[model samples]
Target: MKVVVAGSSGLIGTALVAALRRDGHEVTRLVRRPANARDEFRWDPARADLDERALRGADAVVNLCGAGIGRRRWNGSYKQELRDSRIVPTDVLASAAAAAGVRTLVNASGVHYYGGDSGDRIVTETSPAGTGFLAGLCRDWEAAAQPAADAGVRTILLRSAVVLARHGGMLGMLYPLYFLGLGGRLGSGRQYVPWISLDDEVGAILFALTDDALSGPVNMVGPAPVTNAEFTRALGRALHRPTPLMVPAFALRVTVGEFADEGILHGPRAIPTALEDAGYSFRHPTIGAALAATVGRS
Candidate 1:
């Protein structure tokens, strides 16, 4: 199948593109800069300008455009930026997919759709959208794909969890601290941390593209859910270091502001009800195995 991908330079996009190509699918990357490569095309979501010519003949459109949520403090402007960053690109693609007659739209979303404070309640794809800034963000983010859905396109919203990889995502930013033996639980360390390895993340995306039964929201997370303390311990074990520290809630707020409360500390136990029902197996089902796979990689 021919796939048109936005945000091809991102962490998941990079791996997805390679995996798609390895499996003999034709992958075209949507870029913002002037297009020069045969596999690259230019599109600007801010202006809502897309080269529809490049979108033609595509079997599916995968939209992954978004700014880093935790890369900066959530000021009013940055919060608005986060909303715009996702909505604009997704809206653009959804509208374009319908116009281009694309069959599928596997759009990106987050586990925070269940809110940052879901605590220990087991969340599934059928679960209603929760509250808070991220839940609102995710709600609107997935709604942007309504254009294609209304146009009769098969649409799937991937509510992804904390992706674990060696070079990017949360691990890239937090691993250094863990490696230096400064890593431990946050606050009470009881909040759940839903996670998935990069490999499984890519694999799940591929599965969604071909699976006709999948629609609406699918939790792109692993089967095993662990507490913050368990995650901290797993990382320390993976690195062969001792974790004898804890970053308190107040300290996190002082460091990353409200992200500490909702983004960092609160945990939602999202299960892959949709994926599992769809009959897709997880490559890394446990946090310890995920950490080992991620850290063991070259």
Candidate 2:
């Protein structure tokens, strides 16, 4: 299969590109900078500028474009950046894919589409969009891909969980702290943490690219559900460290502002119902296994 990937420098994007190439799929990467390699194409999503050649004869176009939501304190400007960063690139790629008649469009989304603090409710692909800024951002982000689906291309919206990896992402920020014995639960440690391993995250994207019956929103999370406290303990156990500290909600709010509330204090109990139904097997099915695999390498 011929696959074109956008946001190829990101954590998930890098892994996905490598996995696609390893399997002998011809991969073309869309870069914001000048094209530097044979498999690279330059694109500007802010202006929705992309050469149709990027998508020509492509079996699938996987878009993973977005600014890091937790990369900065949420001011009005940063929030807008979050929305534009995702929506603009997605719109560009989707429109280009439609124009080139690409067979599949696998777009990135977040489990936060179900909103923060879903409590104990199980979130599935059919679950209605939830409330809050991130939810709205995700809604708009996925909606940007409508052109592709409308053009008869199979569109897959990956409502992905907090991806766990050895080097970057949530674990990256926490690894050093935990290694220094500063790791602990945030807030009351009761909020569900929807999460997935980097390996499975990449695997799921590859699965979505070829699985004809899979389209629409798919929750790319683990089969098992875990609360913040459970995750804290598991991570602590994995690192052979004691998680004895607790970060209060007030402290978190003072530290990271709105993100402290939505990104850390609350999360959905999202499950991979669609992926499981499609016969996708997870390499790290449990949080313990996931942390072990990630932290063992760190």
Candidate 3:
């Protein structure tokens, strides 16, 4: 199969491209910079422009383009960056995929589709979208891909969790602090932190690409969801360190603004109902196992 991947420079994108290549699939990177490689093509998401030929003969197009949500404190400008980064590239790709007669479009979405807080309720692919900026952002993000579906293409949304890896994503940010024994849970630490191992994250994308039965929102997370406090304890165990230090909610808000609340302190207890029913086995399913594997890799 031939695949075109946007945001091929990210942590997940980098891993996904390598995995796809390793599996004997032809992959082309849709990059923002100059196309210097044989397998790369330049695209301008800002202008909703991509060479239509890039999509021709492609079996699947995986879009992972977006601004880093936690890169800075959320203000009006950064929030607009968050929304525009996702919606623009997705609109461009969806339009291109439809016109190119692409069979599949595996777009990156998020679990924030379930809202900021779910308390005891566990969300699935079928759950109604929740309220708040992130939830609305996720809703619009997924909506931008509707053109592909309208054109009879199989469109799948990988409603991803906080991806965990030693070198990038959430774990990368936390590993150094944990190594120094200064790591702990955020806020009261009781909120669920839905997560996926980096291996599983890339693997799930591949599964979505080929799994013909799957369409619409598919939660790309572990079967078991752990609370922030539980995750803290498990991560501490993985590093053989104490995790007594805790960051209060107010302190985090002061540091990272609103994301401290919605993105960090509160999260959905989302389950990968679709993945499990599809019999997708996770490489690192448990928090303890995932953390230990992460530390070993470092």
Instruction: Give TM-scores for every candidate, taking all chains together and pairing residue i with residue i.
Output: 0.98, 0.98, 0.98
Tens-digit lDDT string for candidate 2 (37-127): 9999999888888877778899899999999989988999989889999999998888888888889999999999999857889989988
RMSD of 1: 1.2
> For model 3, how does the per-residue alpha-carbon lDDT over 66-180 read when each residue is reduced to its tens digit?
9998888889999999999999999999999999999999999999888876876989998899888899999999999999999998999989999989898888999889889
In model 1, residue pairs whose N, Cα or C atoms come closer than 3 Å (at least 3 residues apart or on different chains), thus clashing, are: none
TM-score of 3: 0.98
Off by over 4 Å in 1: none
Model 2 lDDT on a 0 to 1 scale:
0.92
Query: Can you write out model 1's per-residue Cα lDDT over 1-298, one digit (the tens) per residue?
Result: 9999999999999999999999999999999898889999998888888877978999999998999999998999999999999999999999989999999999999999999667888989878888899999999999999989999999999899999988998999878888887888899999988899999999999999999999989899989899899998889898888899988888999989978887778978988999999899998989989999998433
Which ten-residue region of model 2 has the weakest summed lDDT?
A: 289-298
